[model samples]
Target: MLIMGEVHTGLLRNLGELSETECREVLRLTSGEEPRTWQRPLLYAISPDVLTGVDCRLPSSSGARIRGTGTVSHRATIVGGRVLQGSSYTTLLRSDSDQRLPWSHYLAAPGVVEVYGRPRWQDMADGFVTPEPPMDVLNVGAISGRLMGAVQDSARLDRKTPFKTTRTRLRWLFERDDARGDGRPAMRLTLGRDTMRTLRFTGEPTTDVVAFCEDLALHDWLLTTLQTLIQRALIGTAAPAQIAARLSPAIDHLLHLWMPGARVEEPFLPFWEELERHPGFTRQWTSSVARIRDQITVNTLSLLSVTESRREADGDPSPRRGVPQDRTQSHSHPVRRRIFFRADQRSRRRS
Candidate 1:
């Protein structure tokens, strides 16, 4: 069986992280289907799966016309009550009959798409990962996006995010691992344009694969967001103050969100470990955080120096640090009153 899916990841549309209870309410996608919650490594919640019906053309690498009809399973998830993700997937299989079946037949087998004609697995996978496909091709990503949008538009959210960032889409395909007898999974991740990603896995498909991909998508978003923050800082080109202001959002909202396998199951640990070994996700993240701190320190010292110089230039008494002065006790200068009287007399003469 060929499993295909997409995940959309983004910051929650709230000013601060939500509590566990609030997360449950926000993820309530449908009535009577309560969202599942977990609080071990982090506060996590997932909505019950929903189905989206699709009857469209299946993209093919060789441009073969193949029609598919079925429903896609979708769900919304919140990690750490901060990041929101919408995930959707369906299994592609060959139909026994060439003609389109009734809606009831597809509804009975949820998350399964039946292709009318025989199609090569590689060709279908290639078409999904391709940047542009035919207009009539099934779009699982769009289904996931709509689900995410519904959560963001919920009244439970205040729509006041601390930082402005874009959502990322990750498309994945999983097939049986024919080579390995040990049951270890092999995977490939590709970065694509416009904040899109593709993953191909050769392993036995399990129920946990969707959760693992969601976890992967969350971390990828954190990495991508922090990288964009640093790039916007423009360290040497922009002033220390400007750089600090540009990077402050990461410090306030994103730095603490670097946990890699926090919510992932045991079987997926190796995939996270392998990614760390190659690109060193944590290593790059640590370096970026340190750079932000260093720049903030410099910016702080510069601001203090400028303030001291201004006070000296004005010849004003240095205000006692951390001392709160009462407005009623403020002293009025006698010379300032005399100057005001003289100014008032000049205004009268001019009139």
Candidate 2:
């Protein structure tokens, strides 16, 4: 759908915030909806902002005549006093513009998707170039002379907060004459005494906590790497083989460490041997996938071919059953059979 709107030409060149009334007009035209006082404009275009093409699809090879085959132009006009008083215009470009344009996609956020308004590689590159002058540069000689002063004020205010107050109390405890190493309390819950012998060796509480955190990070890394290797075996063989070949030795080292041990409950002896020995694993896995796919395609073709032949031979007007359909029924029935067979095997294992 295309939306068109006409605005006054006078306020085209001004740059600044627009008035509530002006915003309403733009919203009404583009979104085909009413604008509220609190609502912000999703797409803004003032009169002076010259829109070269309103079409969505235009061929570059078409040269000068290509004129926005699927482009829409929204020109922002800046006028006197920068009040942004001028009216705006909108053009609905053709849908084919999406096809002719080269577009790039990226994850803007978890669910929300943002598409670059332009569809050119150069535009994508140029999009990253910053145009605004730095705030410090704009302020000139009055640069952050009061930065330390503001920081001092913040520090004074923060010192009174309960969290900061706890640190202050802890600091006072450190200065006590009666303070002994064995009397120190736990940093976390107060339920248990965490006294340790004061040693001459240099040891800080912060350093101990940081070391503990680093060990935890290493454990997570090991788990993630192991899972990646396992999943890789199911995906592409060559990539997984290359990764496993490089990482298996390091994984072995981690498993040896008590602090960062492998999470696998069972020994994983067979799984490890399979990965370690199978250079042909990738070739075998890929070949299996190809064979399965080919069998499916060939079976489908043969079933259709057989069904047609049967219909011709019998001269039956009703639809003939294909071999593929029969095979599908046979496959579905095996699921129940397999489940019962596996349960029976488990019963034997228990016995």
Candidate 3:
């Protein structure tokens, strides 16, 4: 069995981090279903799972025609009351019959897509992981995006964010363990262009897998957003003041969000450790943050120096210069006195 999903991560549309109650209100995606909230490791809230009906072709790398019809499960979530995510997934299953079943049958088995014909698992996985799939293929990502859009458009949000950054998409596939208890889990993560990521893992599926993916997506977004901020700063090319201005948002909105695996289950920590070992996500983040702080310090000193120079040029009293002069001291001349007397005498004569 295969469970495929996608998560869309971005900054919440609010000036500052939201309160717990506000997060709940914002994430209430359905009418009767209440969103769940947790505050232990972090302030996290997720809406009730909703299903989207999908009837489309399942792409196969071997050019086999396979049709799948089912409902995709998805939900919206808020992390730290600052980051928003839309997560969606559907399990792939082989159908007992070749024809499409009634809507009731699909509704009964939520988040499970039944394939009409036999399809190679590897071929389907390859096709889905590909950068671009055919238009006719099943698209769980589109469902996730729509859910995110709905939440973003809600009246509960102020629609004002501290920074402007692109949202990241993470498409993941989880294949159930075939050996059951004997084999160890394995994971492979890949980065794609335009802030897209793909992860393929083979493991014993657990209830916390969705939450694990959400955590990964959130951190990935933080990394991507901070990198973009630094690049826009143009460090050596732009003025220190400009660079500092560009990096301020990252410092204010993103620096404290580097908690990798903070909300994931214990079993998933090894996967995060694996990522850190190779790409060293946290190491790069630390370096980027240090550079931002250093630049800000340099810019502060530069501004102070410029202010001091201006004061000196204007003859204002500097600590290095002599004592300040009193502006109240007056200089009187005979020509000024004569003109004042003449003006008074002329006014009196006219009256």
lDDT ranking, high to low: 1, 3, 2
Q: How close is candidate 3 to the true structure, as a TM-score?
A: 0.84
Residue 172, candidate 3: Cα error in Å is: 0.9
lDDT, candidate 2, 1-351, per-residue tens: 112121111111213334455544433323433533332222222222222222222222212122233222222221111112221222222233333343221111111112223433222212212122233211101111121122223221222211110000000001111222554431211111221111011123221221222222233333333334344434333322233333343233323332221222233223223332543333443444454344334434433444444454588645444344444333333334444344334544754
lDDT of 3: 0.81
Q: What is the lDDT of candidate 1?
A: 0.82
Give the per-residue Cα lDDT of candidate 1 at 165.
91
Q: Estimate each model's TM-score.
A: 0.82, 0.16, 0.84
* Residue 275 lDDT (model 1): 88
Write down the lDDT of every candidate, Cα atoms only: 0.82, 0.27, 0.81
Top candidate by TM-score: 3
Best by lDDT: 1
- Point out where model 2 deviates above 4 Å: 1-206, 235-247, 250-253, 258-351
lDDT of 1 by residue, 215-318 (tens): 88988999899999899889887766677878998988788777888877787788889889978888888898999999987665554444443444589666
The positional error of residue 48 in candidate 1, measured at the CA in angstroms, is: 1.2
